[model samples]
Target: MGVASKLKDGFLSAFCLFLIGGAGFVVNVGQLLALVILPFDRHLFRSISTWLGSGFMIAGPFLLEDWGGCKFSAYGEQAPPDSKVLIVVNHGTDMDWAGGLSYLARLGEPFPGGAKAIAKDTLMYIPIFGWLTYFLEFMYVKRDWESDKKTLTKQANQLGTSRLPFYLCLFPEGTRKTPKKHAQSQEFCKKNGYPVLNNLLYPRFKAFTLIAMTMRDQIDGVIDATFAFEGEHPNMSKSLSRKLSCRCNLICQYHPMNELPEGEEELEEWLRNTWVKKDALLDEVLKDQEAFCSKQRKYEWKQEPLDYTKFFALVGVFCFFLVGLSVLMIVNKIIRRGVLVISVITWVAVVAALVINIRPSKVGEKKPDPETSSRRKKAD
Candidate 1:
């Protein structure tokens, strides 16, 4: 084709993508609105989450590094619908959080209702999604024993009664992954006689002890999520935000909710052994799926698909938000000192999404279609 035609085609494609992304945003906002009015409605959130998830699934291919091959597999994928879960994972990079969430959504699971995270107190104020995550029932820790104990107690009581499923994702390494951090964790495990694995930082058992005691009756199962990036990036930091044009791997092992060991001594031993086993399991899974880990899974669903007409209903809402964000950006430039406004908009978007996603915490509130559970099973 001639230069003019080529330019025209490029513009058209860009324009079409913009419109598609814009439409997705509007549907998401409406999904959020619908959730807010029915904040305690578990059924509503599941349906809305599916739509929003599809939006992300569609956009992810464009924005995330390899949108196609992200893999999620689980150990004990099945648990009682209403059971409370304690999720332990290796925290390595910024993409860890988003990658985990994306895998869960694809599995057709909304994160536990009122799920808590053992996170730095400052995460609540993070520029984009951090602010939104703040309102969820999180246990903010000061990285000290005494303070964490008190905070965990208070949040546990609150979460137990919220009637929503609760989960606390902990990073045993206490920070992002690095060669130094990984090496140190390995040393700690070796001194304790634990196996070495390429999966995550050395697992810390202290927090696990507290979690067992704090939510004893309420906690039903434990999940160990092992994350690994595709390709030969030295570490996660180097690969993050760079185009991942292929799928990533998230290997999850679901340990069925078991009784907390009887004695303090036994519990401690259990924690030590669990961490060692988890590391080994991850090594095997990663090795087997090295290539397919970055490839997409094929699953068939026989449900009613989205109504595009209904999806388009909220186009105006998305446009309004986009314009507002754009105007705020322009104002920031004019004020010269208002660069923080961009951060503010991002914060609002992230928080609003979480709020829209809230659901009942109690058991038997509503059971999502078993299909979602099955989809999640594959991802786990």
Candidate 2:
């Protein structure tokens, strides 16, 4: 596709994704307010919010596939709906998680408890998307061993007690692989006498180790997924742009958790070894892309098309509640003036804060400290 065509497609796809996200944000705020005043089980409300919020978020990926002309192909056994899965994948592009989710949704069945990502704490602070993710109960880590250890433990305990089945998605590489980072990874590998990987960074074992130890009994399997895109070097913007024929090859290999080693140290070793095998697999694919693509096991999903009928209905209900709340506040004479004044002040404050926080950094500004950058990349 030409540059102009590509830009048009990208804009259209992004706009659609934004609309879906905006709807989700509205639903989240409405539900949160309801939970404060309504007499309902908090857990039940939380589950409902998560399901609705995730549904909204997942819609973006599917829409991207339809609108952006991105093709997805998956190879390997599909995780059963009842199973609690841990999805560990190499991080190459920002859209890796989105593409993975789209592929999973295409499977003939839905995951038992919906999937949640282990994101960086920074993501939880980004306006609408972040707020919605927080409402959905996604686990956000600071990437510091001292901090994340406690966070992961608490998350594990909560998941263990929850009735819903979950697919916990983790990117063990910790950050996206860039040329500079790749060089650093190769240097570390050489010093440690490990095979240098071209496509993947060395997997960080700390988070995986802690999670495995805490949730060993609860998880059913581990899905090791390697995502690759065709053509020249691909990144998030390119993936979303329809100018190039983007074909995503997602190879997923599922290993039963029971088959993995039990001891913490042994399990960490096993995980690292798995990454070595992944590097080898990526190398083989890179060497002969056509052969690898032709050999992948392809299956048609026999599921119904994604339905937004229920989502629209729920949105209407929330809108009605909000309208009623507004009317009630206005009709009460004693508090009406006070409420209006307070609402105006609150709106102004919120807008000012968002403007300051979302503003772009000045050109030629000094880069953030390494520690801050590291933490941001962990979440990115």
Candidate 3:
């Protein structure tokens, strides 16, 4: 991409992120109000918040397509609305999760109980967007098994008892794929006598196992989804570049939970074996993109037009809140001044916190070796 084009794409992409984050901030405030008003009705509060949050998330796919010129195709049987699902996908690009979730949102119907994911704890610290995940009730883990186990266990228990259905997305690769990480993974596989994957990292089976065992009764099936780009490998930067021309494809295979092994040890073995098949499948698809595309069911984008109704509804809600706040300020000078002072202080505090906690990590920090890092608790 030319420098000028790249800058335009970057600007558009950043604006989209800011728009989504701002929308999420409104939704999150509504969720907090719901929690206070419906304290006794946990299910009602959860459902209200999740669906509201999803309205904001719906913009993700559209923005990606518009800014990046990316096209997506998915081949798989759609899961039933009432059925709970676990989506186990390869994490190739930073946009992979957003793309998949956006596809779900565009599926003509609402996602079951609104889709949630097991994401890295660091994501929870991100400003408005991160706080939105909390409203959606996404499970965030520290990537350490000991700490994550407790969190997942508690979450699973809650899910087991709840009547709402969910599609819990998990990235078994544990991190985004990089050439350096791929090389490290190959070496680790060689030492461990496991198959080396060219396009993916070795699957981390522990988190998958814990989730399956805990929610076995509730989960209907597991969806094995593989995402591939048509041209060069597209990381976050490349995907955001205006010159990006790669069409993305997602192939999903569903396996019933009952068909999986029941015992934990047996299940672990089964998962390893499944990853081997996934490796081979990805190899075939990547090797001959044309042949693979010709054989699979093509996803028709026409069937899933962006839902403008929901988009406008969200905007209307936000406007209503803004107007109400303005009216309150006009009627009460003391309250308005107090609110302005508090808002200023809050913004300063947030900026200071980000500078202290987040900025340093982005500079002069050495990343852990991929080979050994897999065994440590960390987020993808």
Which one wins on TM-score?
3
The estimated TM-scores of all candidates read: 0.60, 0.76, 0.82
**Number of backbone collisions per candidate:** 24, 2, 1
Candidate 1, RMSD to the unseen true structure:
14.0
What TM-score, to 2 decimals, does candidate 3 have? 0.82
Candidate 2 C-alpha lDDT tens digits along 37-117:
335565676667656665565554554465445676667666766677888998776567667667656542233116678
lDDT of 3 at 36: 75
Estimate, for each residue in 1-380, the C-alpha lDDT of model 1 and write its tens digit: 69996676566545543544565555445555666745587555545544444443333222233322233232234345655778777665555555545444333334422345777665555332333244344667766778878887787766565555545677766677666667766776678776675666665566777777767777787777666555542222222223234334555656764655756678677766666676676566467665344342322112222223332444455678768877887767664445576556865765564443221112112347999999999999
Q: Which ten residues in a row have the lowest lDDT in candidate 1?
A: 356-365
Scored by CA lDDT, what does every candidate get?
0.54, 0.69, 0.72
Model 3: per-residue Cα lDDT over 1-380, one tens digit each: 69997678778656654555557667778777888746688888877876776677776665556555677677766666666788988877767765776667755444522778888777777566667777677888886789889999998777666566678899887777766777777888899998877667888888899999998988899888878667764445554544467777777787888898888889878877777887888888878988877777454334355664565576667768778988999999997998899778856655564454332122112477887787675555
Better of 1 and 2 by lDDT: 2
List residue ranges in candidate 3 displaced over 4 A: 1-11, 232-243, 298-302, 319-380
